[model samples]
Target: MDNIFKSAMRGALFFAAACLLLWGIVPEWKSVCAGLLLGAFASFMNALLLRRRVEIVGQAMANRGMRKMGLGLGSRIAMVLCVAMVAYKYPETFNLPATLAASMVMPFILLVSAFLHHKRH
Candidate 1:
């Protein structure tokens, strides 16, 4: 979890700088930046939510016989849905492809972190 957080933060900083550079150089890319930033944010939020959900479920399982998964996964999905919808609606500003691609940043971060950790060990 700590590693996840660290990687997410590092990826976010890298994305932020890339977004800022895009925002400055290309006017059209502003939309790309918007979508990319939003997607990156969703990735970060996902990591945190997943960690929290795991903790909650673990606690519930220890306390009770059969506990339901009470994570607000619906709301989380809705959040990403809302963003995707907005980006889709305004294709000129927020391109769908870029947004979708950017959403995978966290996975990339995780992979890189894992690889580095493995190599170090």
Candidate 2:
């Protein structure tokens, strides 16, 4: 429950930051909302998958050797490749530029926030 709440909050924060930044640059409310929604969905999906992957890897690593860890990494790589292929095939629907921009913005804001939080602490 705590993990789920944390993930939701993180997604919301990323969505808000990307929307605010892009709104300042684009000056279009529709575009800003679109970007925010995209960012939030992407971040939430990524976080959920990442958390699951980490948990699986941790469990596997406890009983298995390093040689057996390739499956987890391979799955992640395959997932990335699949997403890339879909993006490539349906670029019009995907809106690669906006997607990439939102994707980059979320991580950038998260990193900056982490740095600031660390500095303050």
Q: Compare the candidates by TM-score and give the number of the best one.
A: 1
How does each model score on lDDT? 0.76, 0.54
Identify the candidate with maximal lDDT: 1
Q: Please list all clashing residue pairs in model 1, or write none if there are none.
A: none
lDDT of 1 by residue, 82-111 (tens): 778878999878877777777667767877
Model 2, C-alpha of 11: deviation from truth (Å): 6.2
lDDT of 2: 0.54
- Residue 25 Cα positional deviation in candidate 2, in Å, after optimal superposition: 14
Model 1 TM: 0.78
Instruction: Show the colliding residue pairs in model 2.
Output: none
lDDT of 2 by residue, 1-121 (tens): 3344464557567567766676667754554355444545565455456657777777778978563344554654454454445555665444445544544453454555566556776
**All candidates: CA RMSD (Å):** 2.4, 5.5
